[model samples]
Target chain A: GAGVSQSPSNKVTEKGKDVELRCDPISGHTALYWYRQSLGQGLEFLIYFQGNSAPDKSGLPSDRFSAERTGGSVSTLTIQRTQQEDSAVYLCASRAIQGASKAKNIQYFGAGTRLSVL
Target chain B: EDKVVQSPLSLVVHEGDTVTLNCSYEVTNFRSLLWYKQEKKAPTFLFMLTSSGIEKKSGRLSSILDKKELSSILNITATQTGDSAIYLCSQIQGAQKLVFGQGTRLTINP
Candidate 1:
C-alpha cells in the first residue's frame, strides 16, 4: 500500500453505543499506532503494536478502550459503551521498522476515522 | 512521562507573512522531532529534525532542532493562505509511537 488507510471515515453513534474502528497499515510495516484527537486539542497516544504484540498499552484511556492487531498488518480499535468524550478523530499510523530509534524512522499516517458520540 | 508542548495555540496572519512556531519537549531517550501540517483532514508530514544545529529546508518551509534546550522551531517564510493549518509537533520515542504537542493553529487570511 502507498499509505495507511482507515475505514468508515465518519461514524455517528448514540451515547453508550459500541463502535469499532479499523486501521490498515502500509504494506510490510511492522509497527502500527492508534491515537485520538479531541476538538482543539492535540493527538493523544492510545495504543501501539509491534508486529502482533502490543508492548505499550499504557496509553489506553480506560477499560472501555481496547485494541488488537492481527497478522501485524491490520488493527481494530473497539470502544465498549462509548461516552461523549469518545467523540473525536481516531488516527492510525505505521512505520516500516519494528523497533528503532525515533530519530531515524518516520511513520506514515492514515486519513483517520472521525467518531461522533451523539 | 514524555510530553511535547507547542506555543501560540492559535494565530491569524495575512498571506505573504513569515511565521515561526515553537515546540518544546521533555522525554527520555529522545530520538527525533517531527513537524506536521493538518488542514481540515489528516495531517501531512513536513519535516523531521534529529541532529541539532543543522537546518532542514523544503521550499519556503524550514526547521531546526536545539537539543541543548530541548526545543525546536519551524519557520514558514512567504506564507500563503494555503499554509493555513494546524501545525503539530511530535517527539518520537520508538518506531511508530510519538508523543504529540497540542498543536499550533495557524490561519492565514488572504
Candidate 2:
C-alpha cells in the first residue's frame, strides 16, 4: 500500500472477549508502534517493534496487552479480557529505523481502530 | 521519570483570532520534540523541533523549541473553525520512546 493501513476501523466486544487489531505499515518501513488514546486524553504508547528484535513493551499497561510483528511488515495488537476502560482509538504508526537520523523518526499514522468494549 | 505537560487545558476563541499553546517536558536524553494535531481519530504530525532557537512553520502554524527551558510553543495566526482540535506535544526520549502531554483543546468558533 502507499500508506499505513489498519483493519476493522471500528470494533465492539464484550468483557472477557479477546480482540485482535491488525496493521500493515508502509512498504520498507522497519519500525512500527502501537498507541492507545482514551476519551479526551493523550496517546498512551503500548509497544514498539524494530525489525525482529524484542519489542519494547515498557509502555504496555498490563499483561492483557500484547503485540507481535510478523515478517517485518505487518503487526497485530491483541487485547485479552476486555474492559470498558479499554475502549479507545488504537493508532498505528510506522517509520524507518535509521540510527541517529532526524528524518528516520518521522512517523506516518493510520486512521486507527475505534474499539468499544461492553 | 519523564513527563510532558501542556497548559490551557481547553480554550475558546473566535475565528481570525491568534493563539499560542505551551508544552513543557522533563525527559532524559531528549532527542526531539514533536507536535501533532488530533481530531476524531489518529493524530497528524505537525512539527519536529530538534534544535533550540530554530522555528518551524507550516501555513499559519509555527513552533519554536527552547532546549534550555525544556519547553516549546505552537502559534497559530488567523485561526479558522477547521483549526479546532486537540493539539498534542510529545518528547522523544530515545529509540522507540515518545512521552506525550495531555494535550490542549482549542476550539475556534466561526
Candidate 3:
C-alpha cells in the first residue's frame, strides 16, 4: 500500500466486549507503532515493533491491552473487556527503518480506527 | 520517563496571520524531534529536526529545534483556513519510540 492501512474505520462495542484492531503497514517498512488518542487528547504510545526484536509493550495501560505484529508487517491490537474509558481512536504508524538520522524517525500514520465502547 | 510538552493548547487567528507553536521535551537519549499536522484522524508528517539551530521549512511552514533548551518551535506564515488543525510535536527516543505532546489546535478564520 502507498501508506499505512487500518481495518474497520469505526467499531462500536459494549462494555466487557473484546475488540481487535488491525494495521497493515507500508511495504518494506520495518518499524511499526500503535497509539491511542482519546477525545481532546494527544497520541498515547501503546506498543512498538522493530524487526525481530521483542515488541516494546511498556506503554500498555493494563493487562487487558495486548498487541502483536506478524511477520513484521501486519499488526493487531486487542483490547479485552473494553471499558468506557477504552473508547478512543487507535492509530497505527510505520517508519522506514531505524537509524541515527532524522530521516529514519519519520513515521507515516493510518486513518485510525475509532472505537466506541458503550 | 520520556516526556513531551506543547504550549498554547489552542489558538485562533485570521487568515494571513503568522503563528508559532512551542514544544519542550525531557527525554533520555533523544534522537530527533518531529512535527505533525493532524486535521482529522490521520497525522501527516511535517518536519524532523535533529541538529539544533537549523530551520526546516516547507513553504509556509517552518520549524527549528533548540537542543540546548530541549525545545522546538513551529512557525506558519500567511496561514490559510486549511492550516487550521492540531499541530503535534513528538520526541524520538533512541529506542525508536516517539513520545508525543498534547497538540496545539490552530483555527484560522477567513
Please report, as a residue range, the 10-residue window in candidate 1 chain A with the lowest summed lDDT: A96-105
Per-residue accuracy of model 1 over B1-110 as CA lDDT, tens digit each: 67899998999999999999999999777777899999976788899887643579999999988888988999999999999999999987754478899999999999
What lDDT does model 3 reach?
0.90
**All models: lDDT?**
0.88, 0.88, 0.90
Task: Spell out the clash pairs found in candidate 2.
Answer: none
Candidate maximizing DockQ = 3
Per lDDT, the best of the predicted structures is: 3
lDDT of 3 by residue, A44-105 (tens): 98888887454588889999998887787898899999999999999999988746566577
Off by over 4 Å in 2: none
The residue ranges of model 1 lying beyond 4 angstroms of the native Cα positions read: A98-104, B94-96
Residue B81 error for model 1, in Å? Answer: 1.0
Between candidates 1 and 2, the one scoring higher on TM-score is 2
TM-score of chain A of each: 0.93, 0.94, 0.93
1 against 2, candidate with superior DockQ: 2
- Candidate 1 chain B has its poorest 10 consecutive residues by lDDT at B46-55
Name the lDDT value of residue A102 in candidate 2.
68
TM-score of chain B of each: 0.93, 0.94, 0.94
Calculate DockQ per candidate and list them.
Answer: 0.62, 0.69, 0.85
Ranking by DockQ: 3, 2, 1
